[model samples]
Target: MHFIEMQATARAVRAKYAQVESERYGRPWTAEEIMLGFLGDVGDLAKLVQGKAGVRPRDDLDNALAHELADCLWAVLTLADTYGVDLEAAFADTMHALTQHLDDVRRSP
Candidate 1:
């Protein structure tokens, strides 16, 4: 699926989670809570990467790494949506700047 499609799906999933949390905890997760969760996911992803690189031992390495990556992506997509960021445009602009920087550096003495 395209990035936009994936982002839409992520938002839907986030809404579902919020509903679940509200039913269980009497409140939905706040944006700060979501960001904390995202940070945890990122930490797990880093560990999975280390395991994949043989720097650490972990079980179910393949599945865990894939799951962690998906978790991270979901967090990023949802956070961007919450913050009103146009990720597609931001990504394009950032990549264009990086490409130009690399080209300029390559031409330098």
Candidate 2:
């Protein structure tokens, strides 16, 4: 799906999680808490990458890798939404800059 569609889905999922958390813990997760959860997901993603590369042994390699990547993407989309960032614009600008830099480097030598 497109990035905008993914972001909308992520936001909906985040709202569901917030409701669940409020019911369980008496408060919805703060952005900082969400970020901490993201960090945990990132660690899992790193291990999965290692397993994919044969640097580690993992029993649920394929499924786990896909799940972790989705988790990371959800976290990023949610965080960007929470912080009022225009992620699409930011991504486009960043990629354009990188492409220009690479083109300049190639021309130089």
- Using lDDT as the measure, the top candidate is 2
Lowest-sum lDDT 10-residue window in model 1 = 52-61
User: What TM-score does candidate 2 reach?
Assistant: 0.93
The TM-scores, one per candidate, come to 0.94, 0.93
User: CA shift at 9, candidate 2, in angstroms?
Assistant: 0.5
Please give, for residues 1-109, the per-residue lDDT of candidate 2 as tens digits: 9998999999999999999999999999999999999999999999989998999877989999999999998999999999999999999999999999999999995
Which residue pairs clash within candidate 2?
A: none
Residue 2 in model 1: shift from native, Å?
1.1
Q: What is the TM-score of candidate 1?
A: 0.94
